[model samples]
Target: MSSASTVAKKKQTPQNTLSLHYLGDRVLRQPTKRISKINQSVRDLAQEMVQTMYAEQGIGLAAPQVGVNKQMLVIDCDPNNTATPPLVLINPEIQTYSPELATGEEGCLSIPGVYLDVVRPEAVQVKFRDESGRPQKMKASGLLARVIQHELDHLHGVLFVDRVRNDLVLTEALNKQGFSAKAVQPIKS
Candidate 1:
């Protein structure tokens, strides 16, 4: 098998489909605990998360979304291509961010069909441990930066909708998706 095929097989999640915990789920509001050690179980969990993300056609996913209260997240900016690879971050923390801010349409697998514009730093320097427990740091920009920030918010019990500036549009979008606009904990820019 080719390397890409090997990767696909390796990244596959659990046997049963991973169910996404929706926006109103209390699990989504609880802050995730930092992972102290990475092991086979953690690796397995991350694999399951990657599979769930791909199955849901999402670019990023957090441990909270899958009912796991751990600081873990998976991201693949180019999810359309298997060759692009994916990142599994455990206990990720942003060290610094660029002064430049950019607004982009953001969505969550947990929130399902709701999409809203959120403004965030265009670039970031982050530190985290890989799936194998190896410490790593990265400078991320563009879609990668957005995805990292978005998923990081999940680790802190913050949803993208909370960061949306326009309350009118946000309420309309969430209500249309059958989510209560009251659930949003807006953060002023």
Candidate 2:
């Protein structure tokens, strides 16, 4: 399997690529199954996911967002920087989160045109398998941590909108995007 660094960082035309499931899609609501095996097939999917994410100009993407039921995600916070490589995480698990909290506006490739503020831990320690099936661990902070948490939510059948605290903002954003407010299954804290 090719390394995640081999995937191009530049955006391509999204036509005929993996279709991104939207906010109301049932696929996005379903929990993803952990990838029991990390082979060429999983690597290929991760490569394609990275491509799709770049095409959609998204910082991160999950398997479920593309109608796959696997616990996998691709993230590249700095797509324009060729020096940095994108990350492919299989069966990612957050081991710990910092007590500090940060609120930031979040958006999803699935829920286009709707960005809302959601609070999340300021830092996180995560463990997962890389494309090579080797276990890996990392501590992340700032935007990287937020992206990790956001994409991880997709694996658990959750959306950033669900974590949104303001109903009026979420409803208005969804409505303006031609999406039904009923689609949001709010996660109570």
Candidate 3:
């Protein structure tokens, strides 16, 4: 292997750990910029995001959630398995989605303890760049699909709470969790 490749691989430790930006923070609302290049720095950030996700016991997280306004996210549905690696998506785009919709209980690391019911497509096809900067595409379903859609929303400055159909329940849950309901920018379907 090339020395550069070896160096990049060795730098994959969790040293660049970032703090989460909570709801009501303008950083979370600002749209993320597309990554022009996936270099070592970007890879390190992804590694740190993975560490933070595991530390927070979250299945998914976005760059904006970590106060980074870049189109990136990390997800690992099965955190218990060390053999399965976390998926790092850079400049991800949902190419298509299944017409069939399903409701799933969703939550955000940014919002902390608040969870709400969200309706989304049962399946999705997404295109993105891998950590190695290679173009990649895949179809996702079940928990993986739900987490992808949720994390992708963060790139567009959207939150899962925005998709909640019941305002009262959402507001109650947010309030109970010490979060403000006003922070949610609900998308009217």
What TM-score does each of the candidates earn? 0.92, 0.94, 0.91
Worst 10 residues of 3 by lDDT: 1-10
Of the pair 1 and 2, which is ahead by TM-score?
2
Q: Provide C-alpha RMSD values for all models, in order.
A: 3.6, 2.5, 4.2
Please report the TM-score between candidate 3 and the true structure. Answer: 0.91
How would you encode candidate 1's per-residue C-alpha lDDT over 135-165 as one tens digit per residue?
8888999999999999999999999999988
lDDT of 2: 0.89
lDDT by residue for model 3 (51-147), tens = 7887778888999999999999888887776555678888999999999999889989888888888999999999998888888888998899999
Badly placed stretches (over 4 Å) of model 3 are: 1-16
Q: In each prediction, how many residue pairs overlap at the backbone (N, C-alpha, C within less than 3 A)? A: 1, 0, 0
Candidate 1 backbone clash number: 1
lDDT per residue for candidate 2 within 153-179, as digits (tens), equals 999999999999999988999999999
Deviation from native of the Cα of residue 188 in model 2, angstroms = 0.8
- lDDT against the true structure, each candidate: 0.84, 0.89, 0.84
Model 1 per-residue lDDT at 111:
88
Q: What order do candidates take by lDDT, descending?
A: 2, 1, 3
Question: Where does candidate 1 have its weakest 10-residue lDDT segment?
Answer: 1-10
